[model samples]
Target: MEQERDFTELSMMSKTRWNDNELRYFQHALSQLLPYVNPEGLTILHEINKEMQNRD
Candidate 1:
């Protein structure tokens, strides 16, 4: 299986013009907070993806 790259580090490299600076910062912050958002960590999204396709 392939491993996912870390998002916090990834978003840190993104550059934005002045208008989008806050969005860039928010994305970076959200990336770091993802691990703590759910007790299942990242597995929640994977488990739901297949079911989502069947729903819509």
Candidate 2:
């Protein structure tokens, strides 16, 4: 869980640094990769998505 959270935070930071097109590509890659992740990781990703949405 800790590793997953760390990864999510890192990914979020990277995403924030991206321009619109780069962010879209990042999100697309993340969506494709998510199916292979564990449930807990998925949950963390979902939470992160929610936070991002709230920020917007």
Candidate 3:
């Protein structure tokens, strides 16, 4: 269960810094996650890493 959440959360993070090419990949990856997560929830999870990093 924890591992699943970690993997899902990792997918969310990948979207944060995506460029054009990366965005395509991010979207592709995220499509797989959408069935399990909503856009608003994903946005919160997505920003977690970035927000943590900025604090350092």
Model 3 stretches astray by more than 4 angstroms = 1-18, 41-56
Which RMSD does model 3 reach against the true structure? Answer: 9.3
Which structure among the candidates has the greatest lDDT?
A: 2
Q: Ten-residue segment with the worst summed lDDT in candidate 3?
A: 1-10
Q: Candidate 1, which ten residues in sequence have the lowest lDDT sum? A: 14-23
Better of 1 and 2 by TM-score: 2
RMSD of each: 13.0, 8.2, 9.3
Question: What is the per-residue lDDT of model 3 for residues 1-56, given as tens digits with 9 covering 90 to 100?
Answer: 22223344555554444334444444456556777878875775456445445545
TM-score of every candidate: 0.32, 0.46, 0.34
State candidate 2's TM-score: 0.46
Model 1 regions more than 4 Å off: 1-18, 38-56
Could you tell me the lDDT of residue 55 within candidate 2? 52
Which of candidates 1 and 2 reaches a greater lDDT? Answer: 2
lDDT of 1 by residue, 1-56 (tens): 54444545533453222123333444455457786767643443333343344444
Q: What is the lDDT of candidate 1?
A: 0.43
